[model samples]
Target: MPNSSANQVSVIALTQIGAALARKIQGQLPISQLVLPEKYAVDGEQSFGRCQFKATCQMLFKTSDVVICIMATGIVVRTIAPIIKDKTVDPAVLVIDERANHVISLLSGHVGGANAWTNRIAKLVKADPVITTATDTEHVQALDTLAQRFDGWYPDFKYATKLINGRLAAGDRVNIYIDSDFRGIVTDLTGFTEINEVADDRFDVPLVIISDKTGYPKRQNSIQVIPRVNVLGVGCRKGIPYDAMQAAFVAFCQQHGLTWRSFYQVGSITKKQHENAIHYLAATLNIPVKFYSADNLQTVADHYSQSAFVKKTVGVGNVANTAAELASGSRTFTDRFATDEVTLAASRKKLKVDDS
Candidate 1:
């Protein structure tokens, strides 16, 4: 089994069964259902309502990395399919038994770390792991052998598991840039895009998702590709004058045609703990941010796209660079700013993003 831990993950449950499971798995994992007061409920009724379902599911899907559909009379599945069918973040769909804690990895089990998760749940709840994915049953094979297929170029493809399979079928090459010997061919791993599977970084790759996963992709011949056309993020005091930050961010975005969502993470001056501006930006851009402390900024030395003036003055890359780097999962970006100084930077990762 793949050894991994739950870092930043989100969960969505369709029914009471799903909600119960979500609550049980809390702390050990991430969940989508948040306890809300009756007054805040959209249904204008008591605890749960149809409106609540719609609004809750919408919010849940937005932040979730996976969606777990609890089995019932199948109403739960029916109610939430349309909402999820069109979601941008392809959530790993799983079906769990309401009666027993048994977890069935119906869709995404490996690529989204559901396989490992399945076992964890089984042991915790003392239930069965009904993992039907072929890769899990068989140890040797490419991701294609077990990957669930879905439509590429669709917002739904963002579902990690479905997208992996779709990318493989679409002829996206898997450029494994690992150093030392690594087991399994490119085809053997679930959702690999490349057929060559050779241990060479020189192979062509469209999307480069850098991870700390060892021996997967070698560094020697790897090329750095910024995955976004524009990246803008800002950090300021609680009520600091928004002029500089807003101007910088807007100017940078206007200079490049990029959607607000492209801005990934926000690196702020540690002193301004939980500032209002960050919350406002999150609302405006509709993107989540992974806040970084000053020390964490050091690891991104290589990827920081710092300008001469920005670098000389702030002594770090701009916010856009940090956001882009963090969003793209690359270590080649970082930015810094003072409490009063709201900084922004931009990248061209959107140069050739597929519209299809």
Candidate 2:
């Protein structure tokens, strides 16, 4: 499959033949745009002249979702060496020969999706795809790739992943505990034993837990996969500062042993849809904000604590709790807190496989 997660693709070619090959690759990827030197660029195509290739690459590395350098692997390597970041944050980087004979997954093979894009482009142009990730070659799924498949994320502890993938590569059946909600989503369970609980006895073996909750007792060989399933609900006074709202939200999570990473979106009543503080909090969290009308929230308001003042003002007795329950389609709230100025609540959306 083409890398659907990659919204923007930058194809860089320095030579005439490479430019022509890049054009063919770009034809298959409609989201891709060509970047060629002035001498090789066609009309209306992005072009860079003498001493500009390095700067152009640096820009694309930061802005593009996928960077395909159709030139010598070494040149691309040296150019990106200074700007290379962790695979968790870096864009996928691919190297293709001028003749399009091979598409090499040079960097960020798993987490950044280089391997997937390389395979896609190679298939498009009938080229050999060179993917060297050990798990891929050994026909075992890596922890990072597995998380990506389920729209989840692993911790930044690389040692845990390396140990787990190494065990899988050695043909070991790792014990995995996928939350009941996510268990039905995965189609394959070839080399894994699904465990009901994570006990101390399993620490000796490589263990993997996939859940949206926090506080999983894990050893060095354990991999915790956090899916974006939590939905946040907010209620703040008029013109509440962003700092106050954020402080209260963080406090709420900390008190409930929750982490912000698992939150996918924020919910609020339509009466507070124009509230700047809620919008700012959502932006800082890098998640979208969803607004529901007071009438919608009223259906679930009775199940939660209510305030007469709020009901008189916004036509709903509760905002944070009701909004979370309504937006997540959950029958109840997961966590909630209330203060004179701000109120916060959380809910878990119903989990199911989203093939789209």
Candidate 3:
């Protein structure tokens, strides 16, 4: 097993090349994601379910700090490009062509903290990690990296420093979730006071603080950091002719009988021109608009019921499902996000979210 570190990483891909590469990378690194085949996604193993690729990517993007692209063509590019097109949360994006000959560092190489990840993954694979991030290339101070140091890292939070210059500074009451067997989590620097048993949900803890103990459960709820269910995905035209995208999103949530407070973010395709709707929705709710590039979104893939209209409107099927999956880790069939209309899945089963 990989000895996990401060943060978690998830890989998204279905192709033989992608799956093989993901396994190779996970062996050396601790932070990782689930590697699923194209089947067992949408409609079971009956049809090749790349149909919902965009939704799948969105779900994975929500759960990941970085995304590694392994496909070279088709909905992969079309699904991933729109995510990073506008100013956004910028997950670490690295690409390895299907041929496995070269790796390309596309976006957020520094802040997404993929540089160190590359160094670790490159050694496992033959090809070098192609990093284009200026700060990584120049070896400058990264605010995100500085905050994640775990030792006296009291201050750290940002959106896109180079692009839109957005910031989400850290504050008090930051919940830090770790595994039950996490012996080294609680320390003098960490301020965690309790570790309660929650339902079989909750993996989307955005803000985290180090816990100050050592008797973490080997099979407890804290194993999966910020594990949660019911992540809401929002989308609209880039420059959606609206002043309150958050309000609209909230209305949608309310209309659907969703617990408004349960939602952690408002997300969409990364196009500023069409982002007014999503940004408005997020700003109105004072939540973050976690954006991902199309390529970044493709890795996890989606399992939505795709239609011709959906293809024309969303352009891909994998993102929403992908984001939901990421928002709740790889466990997509959580209470609120189940494929069926019924909302209860784990509570009745008495399962826990972080059970290892």
Tell me, by TM-score, which candidate is best.
2
**Residue 177 of candidate 2: its Cα lDDT?**
89
lDDT of 2 by residue, 246-353 (tens): 899888887877778888889998988899999999999899999999988998887888989989998998888888888788854554587779988888776556
| Candidate 2 lowest-lDDT run of ten | 1-10
Better of 2 and 3 by lDDT: 2
Against the true structure, whose lDDT is highest? 2
CA error at residue 276 for candidate 1, angstroms:
26
Candidate 1 residue 191 Cα shift, in angstroms, is: 13
> What's the residue-level lDDT of 113 in candidate 3?
63
| Number of clashes recorded per candidate | 27, 0, 62
**lDDT (0-100) at residue 222 of candidate 3?**
26
lDDT per residue, candidate 3, 7-100, as tens digits?
2665656676566666667555665654455553233321125455576665555556777767663545567676664323657666666566
- The runs of at least 3 residues in candidate 3 whose Cα sits more than 4 Å from the true structure, single-residue gaps closed, are 1-7, 27-31, 39-48, 73-77, 84-88, 140-144, 147-356
lDDT of 1 by residue, 1-356 (tens): 11123324444444555456655665365433333223332333223344565565444444456655455526545655666553224455555676555776654455555666667667766779887654455442233222221101112223433444344445555443221112221223433433233443344453332221223333432322212223334544346554555555655445443334345444443444466666566556665555554444445644654556644443454544454455445432223333335655433222222222
Report lDDT (CA) for all predictions: 0.44, 0.83, 0.45
Model 3 alpha-carbon miss at residue 176, Å? 30
